[model samples]
Target chain A: MKTPALIVSGVLALLLAGCATRRVDESPVAAGQTTFATKEEVAAADEHDDWDTVAVVEVHDPIEPVNRGIFWFNHQLYTYVAKPFSKAYKSIFPKWVRHGIGNAYENIKYPIRVVNHTLQGRLDRTATETGRFLVNTTAGVGGVMKPADKIPALADVPKADTGQTFSKWGAPHGPYLVFPVLGPTTTRDLVGTAGDTALNPVAWVGLLFGGAAWTTAISAPSGAHGVPDQMDRYDMATKDALDPYISARSGYIQYREAASER
Target chain B: MKNIFFLLLGLCVGAMTSNASTEAAEANLRSTIDQVLVVTKKGKGGQSMANQLTPILVRHMCFESMTRRAVGPGWRQFTPEQKAEATKLFSKLIIRNYSKKFTPGELAEIEFLKPSSPGAGKVEIPTKTVYKGSRYNITYRLEDRGSWLITDILAEGISFVANYRAQFDVLVRKGGAVAVIASLKQSLERT
Candidate 1:
C-alpha cells in the first residue's frame, strides 16, 4: 500500500514539474502564427464578430496543450474505468443506500468546509455548518440522512471549501487545468484541493491509525460514495460537446464562476 | 374619457396576454420533455428515436442562432451554403448527442419552477430533474420567436452555448470556418 502511494506521489511530482515548466504567456495562439498565417488572416478580418476570441483573450490558458493532454488521459480513464465502476456501484446499491453513503462522506468532510468558511471570516456559515454537522451526526444517525436540513438555521448555510477561501483571500484563478483522475480544476483550486485533502479526517486517520485500519477507512465509504454523481456530472457536461475536453473546461469554468458567486 | 378607459383596458389585457403566453411556453416545454421521455421509455437506439426527436428539436430549438454563436466570428467567414450546412450538421449533432442521454427508467420526472421573465422576449424556466434519489437543476432559456424556442440549456448553471463557444474558439483559431465545419462533421460521424 505504501509502495503504491509512493509511486503515485512520484508520478504526480513529475507531472507537476512538467506543468511548472510549460507555463507559457497568455496567448497560445501566438505559437500557431508561423504555421497558420491564413487562419490568422481570417481571424484578423472577422475580429469584431469573434466572441470566442474576445471572451477567452483574458482567460489565461497558458498550458492548454498540456491541459488538453491531461484532459484526454482523464477522459480515457473515465470512459474505460471510472464510469463503468461508477455504473456498477450504482447498479449494485439502492438509491437511498448510495445517498446514505454520500451523506456519510459529506459528513466526514465537514471539517474541511467548516474550516474554510472560518478562514474566509464567514462566522455565520461556520457556526451553522458546525451546528449542521453536530445535528446530523447525532440526530441523522452518523449522517445517513441530513436531518440538520430540517433545522431552519442550518438549512440555508452555503457549503464552502478551501478553494472559496483562497478566492476570498484574493487569489486569482490561475489558468484552466485538467488533472489526471480529478477532471477540471484551476491552479488555485488545485492548492485548495490539496489543503482540503490534508484537512480531511480520513487522511488523518490514515496517518494516525496506519496499516489495516487506515486502508479500510481510505478505501471504503468516502472513496466509493461520490463516484456516480461525478460520472453523472461529467456525462451531462460533455454529452453535447463537439469536443468533450473543450466543453468540460467551459462547463467547469462557468460552474466555478457560479459557485464563487455564492 | 373613453380613450383613457380604452388605454387602461388595453394595458390590462396586454399584461394578461403576457402571463398567458408564459404559462403556454412552460406547458410547451413540459410537453417536449414528455415526448423525449416517451422515446427514452421505448429504449430503441439509433435512427428511430433520432427520427422522432429531430423534428421536435428543430421546431423547438434555435439551432441556427446557437450554431452562429458557437461558431462566433468564424460564422461570418462561412458562405450561405456553409452556414446552412453547418447549422444542419450542428443541429443533427445536438439531437444525436441529446438522444443518448435518455436512458430507460433513469429519468423519473421533471418539475418546472416559476418561469422567470429574464428579458422582454425571453423566459428562463428552472426545472428540478429527479433521477432515482438525486435531484439536479436543469434550466431552459427560451426565446419568443413567435413561439418559445430553446436558445440555451444550463445544467447546474453550466451554459451549453458558453461551453461550446470556448471550444469553438480554439478550433477557429487553429483552423477556420472550414476546420470548424470539418470538426462538426467528424463529431457527427463519431456519434
Candidate 2:
C-alpha cells in the first residue's frame, strides 16, 4: 500500500481498536435507565427515587493551573487562526446563506444521532427521532431541521422520558476531564469527538487544509467567542454552590436513565 | 504610469473609506446595543420587552452566534427554515422568560464587564444578577458579524444549553416532544 493508504489503514485500525475495547471509565449510563426530565421537573415530580440523588463526585479536580492551561491552549488556537476564517465566512455569507449552511450541517447528523442512540440501547431516541424528523420536516418549516421536535401527539410519555436514548448510544460519561479550551469532557466523549468530526461537514472541509493548523485557524476564533458564554454559564450553574459538577453528572445520568425505565 | 497611479490612489482611498465605514458601523452598533440593553434591563412589561429587543438584538447579533451556546451543538442540526423559526421562537421565549425571571432593579448595579474581544471575532460581556441576596456572574458570548451580537448567555455556570436540555428533557417527559413545543409556543405567545 502507498503512504496515504497506509495512513488510512492505520486510522481505520485505530477506530476499530477503539470500538473493540470498552473502558469502564467510558461506559455511559445504560440508555434504558436515562431520564429525560429537566432538573426542576425531576425535582418537582416528587418521586424522589434513589438514583435521583446519585452524586457526581469529582473523581478528580486538577488544580486551577491545569484547567487554565487547557483553557489557554483552546482559546489561543481559536483566537489567532480559526476565527479569521469564520470572520471571512461572515463577511462573504449573508444571514440566510449562513442559515442554509448551518441547516445542511445539522440535517445530515440525524442518522448519526439515531445510530448512536440505538447502539446505546436508547429506545426513546428511536421514538423521539421518529417524531423529531416527521414533525420537524412538516411543521418545522419543512424540516429545515431544528433540535427540538414537537408533534401534536405525545405518543409515548413514560417510555420517552423514563429512559431510552441515552442508554443505547450514550458515550460513557467516563472519568472527569478538563480540556484545554474545549472545557470539560471525558475519555469516552473525547473519542466520540472523532466520530462527531467524521460526520461533520465543517471538519471535512477543514481537513482539506492539509494540517491541524488550518483546522485550528478556522475553528479557534469561533471557539474563543464562546468562552465567555461558556464560563458565564458555568458560573450561573455553580453559584447556588450546590455542586454543579454533580448536577451535570446527574443530568447526564438521568439523561441515560431512560433505558432503565424501559 | 498614469493608470497605475490612479489605481494606487483608488486602493488607498478605498482602504481609508472601508476602515472609516467599519469603525463607524462598530461604534453605531455598539451604542445602539448599549441602549437596547438598558431598555431590556428595565423589565417593565410582560411581552413588550421582547418586541422591543428583537430588532436591536437581531441587528447586532447573528442568529447562529446568539443561539450556538444556548442551543448547544445540536444547533447545527437546524435547517435554514428551522434555524430561522427556532431563532425567532427561542430568542423570544428565552429573553422574555429571562426578563421575567430577573428584575431590572436587581441587575441595576451590574455593569458590563469587559475583555470583550478575547480573540478572533468572539467577545464576552460579564453581566451580574442578584437574587435572594446573592450576586451571580452571568456572561454572554458576542460573535462578530462585523459587529457584536449575543450568541449565548451563561448564568453563573449554567448555560442556556444545559438549561434548555433540562427543560426539553422535562417537557419531553411531561408530554413528549409535542408538549415541549406546545409549551415553548405558549410561552412565546405570552411573551
Candidate 3:
C-alpha cells in the first residue's frame, strides 16, 4: 500500500511541476474582479491562431485615463442629449426629409473631399467628387436629392477626408485621444479635423452669415441629420463589448485604415 | 449521350436543392432570432422563459465552435475536463448576453438583407437593426453542420468571437486555461 501511494504522489508532483514551469499566470483569478480591465492586455495578446487573423488596429493610448473619461462623457452626451434630440427631430420630420437634409450636409462638405482627394494625388477621384458635387447641387436641388446616385460612376466614390490625406502623406497616428463631444481621434487626425473644418462651409456660416443664431440653426439640423448614424455605430461597438474603450478605439482605427485604403 | 444528359440533369437538380437548402437556413435563422426577441420582449422573462430559450439557441448556435475559436491556440492546453468546463461557461456567457441584448423592441425594426454565401457551408445574413432611433448594421454568420447554425456575429464590423478572443488570448497566454475559465466566470457574473 505504501509503494502504490508513493507512486501516485510522485506522478502528481511531476504534473504540478510541469504546470508551474509551462504557464506563469500571475492573474488573481478572482471572480468578478477583472474582465478586460486594461488595453495593455488586448495589445499584448498576439496572433495565436487563424481567429486572430482579423486585424484590430492596436493604437498607443498613453492618455488612456483621460481618453476613458472623455469616452464616458461622450457616451453620456449621446445617450441623454443627442439621442433624445434626434428622436424628437425624427418625430417632427419624415425620414426622406431628414435624409435629404443629411445629403445636403454631405454635399456641403464636398469641398473637403475634393481638396483631400487632390492632395492624395488621386486626380481621378478628385474629378469624380467634383462631378458628383455639381450634379447633386444642380439637379438634386442643393443636394436635397442624390441625382448623382443614379449614375453608377458618381455613386460610390470613396469618401476622402483631411485625415486620410495626412495618412496618404505618410503621417503616423500619434497618441490616441478622445474629445468630450468629438469622441475618438488621434493627434494627427485631430489636426486633420481642424483642416477639414477649415474647408467646410458650415464653419464659415458664422463668418459669412455672421450670427450665433444662424450658426446654431444650421448646426442643429446638420448635427441631427447625421448624429443618429454615428450613435448607432457607438452603440454597436459598446453594447456587448468586453471593454468598451478598447472596442471603440480598435474599431475607430480599423475603420480609419479601411477608409484610407478604400 | 444519354448518360451525359442524365448526369447534367442530376447536377441541375442538385444545384436547385442546394439553393433551397441555403434559403431555408436563412429563413430558419430569421425565425429563430425573431423568437428570441419575442421572448426577451415579453413582460415577464423568467427563468422558465430563459430555459426555453436555451434549447432554441443551442439548436441554432454552434457554441462549441465559438468557444474553441475564441479560446484560440491555448484551447489545446486545457485538459479534457477543463475544455468541457470552458465551453459550457462560454455558452452560458454568450447566451446571457444574446438573450438580454435587445433594446426593448430593436428587432421589431430589423431589415434583413438577402443572405449570401461567403464560402462553402457558410451563409451570412446582414441586417440593419434599429434601437432608440439608432440604426446598427449587424451581420450573422452561420455554418451548415447538419443544420445551419450561427458561428459568429459582426456588429458594425466588430466581431463577437474576435472581441472575446482578444481578451482571452491575453489570459491564455499569461495564465493558461485556469485563467480563461476564471475570467469567463467573472464576465458571466457581471453581465
TM-score of chain A of 2: 0.44
lDDT by residue for model 2 over A94-188, one digit each (tens)?
64545544444444455555655554455676677667656655555644545342343522222221112221232233344567545565444
Docking verdict class for candidate 3: incorrect
How well does candidate 2 reproduce the true complex, by DockQ? 0.03
Give the winner by TM-score: 1
Candidate 3 lDDT, tens digit per residue, A80-197? 9988977787799887887888888989999899988887779999999999999999999999898897798986577889877766655656667798897898766777898898
**DockQ of candidate 1 compared with the true complex:** 0.30
Q: Say which candidate scores most in DockQ.
A: 1
DockQ of each: 0.30, 0.03, 0.17
TM-score against native, each model: 0.76, 0.34, 0.64
Q: Count of backbone clashes for each model?
A: 0, 65, 1
Global lDDT for candidate 2?
0.46
Isolated chain A TM-score, each model? 0.76, 0.44, 0.78
Q: lDDT-based ranking, best first? A: 1, 3, 2
Write the number of the candidate with greater lDDT, choosing between 1 and 2: 1
Please, what are the lDDT tens digits per residue for candidate 1 over residues A1-262? 3454355445444433211111112234433221112344444644334333222312446677898899889888989998899989989999889898888888888989888787777788888999999999999999899988678788656678877766655555666677788777877778779889888887787778766577576758767777887888788777667788767766776666556556
The alpha-carbon lDDT assigned to residue B36 of candidate 1 equals 77
Q: Which stretches of candidate 3 lie over 4 Å from their true place?
A: A1-49, A209-217, B1-62, B73-82, B85-157, B169-191
